[model samples]
Target: MNKEYLIRWIKAAGIRAIKTMAQTAVATIGTTAAMSEVNWVMVASTAGLAGIMSLLTSIAGLPELKV
Candidate 1:
């Protein structure tokens, strides 16, 4: 793969990871007393899901932006 393609993949993955983490955190906030008490499994699963989604989207050549 080319350098530009690799950079795009990395950017997409990072964006996905952050978005997943935020969503997971919001979902966990109501059930947990503190951030430290949040479920590890949920966090890991969210990350994994984000990674898979990013990879799939990248491969599918989906537009990352629209205006």
Candidate 2:
């Protein structure tokens, strides 16, 4: 692949990662008082889902809205 394509993929992945982490953190930490208790499996699953979504969007492009 070209450098530009690689860069796009990296950017997409990073964005997805950050979004996933934020959502997971809020869900886990916002409702609980225990800061030390965290679910690693749930975090990993969220990351994986984010990665897959980003990859799919990058490859297929986003759908256009219809008026």
Candidate 3:
């Protein structure tokens, strides 16, 4: 792919990753009974993992983008 396509893919992947991370974090936080009892570290780690997975998935092939 050319530089433009590559750049677009990267930007899209990054946004996807951020969205995934936010979703994961929110879901994880929801699992807790109360906000005060939430484990910030665990939520962050889980979200970070999700973001990495998103990026990896993008590398494989972004379903949202057509070939």
Candidate 4:
């Protein structure tokens, strides 16, 4: 397993996580707008988790793993 490969994997994962978070955020907002009363807490919680995942993935990508 090359270090560079691991780094690349981490970078890819980070990108994916970010994209997923964005999509989820958009969907949640759209749904909330459509509904009169949305579970704000749930939406916030999920978004928070996604944000954390994105951050972790980004940090992992930062490590200069031998690619």
What are the per-residue Cα lDDT tens digits for candidate 2 across 1-67?
A: 6777667666765676577667765675544436566666765676567656665665654233111
Q: After superposition, how far is residue 14 of candidate 3 from its true place, in Å?
A: 0.6
Top-TM-score structure, candidate number: 3
Q: Number of clashing pairs, model 2? A: 0
| lDDT of all predictions | 0.65, 0.61, 0.91, 0.71
Give the poorly placed runs of model 3, Cα more than 4 Å off.
34-36
Error of 4 at 42 (Å): 2.7
How close is every model to the real structure, measured as TM-score?
0.50, 0.49, 0.87, 0.59
Best by lDDT: 3
* lDDT per residue (tens digit) for residues 1-67 in model 3: 9888888899999999999999999999998636668898999999999999999988988876776
Answer with 2 or 3, whichever has the higher TM-score.
3
Instruction: Give the alpha carbon lDDT tens digit for every residue of 1-67 in model 1.
Output: 7778777777876786577667765666546646467676776676567656666665655376321
Clashes of 1: 0
- Against the correct fold, how does model 3 do in TM-score? 0.87
lDDT (tens digit, per residue) of candidate 4 on 6-61:
66876776667777777777778779878876777767777768877776766655
Model 1, residue 34: C-alpha shift (Å): 11
Candidates ranked, most accurate by TM-score first: 3, 4, 1, 2
Global Cα lDDT for candidate 1: 0.65
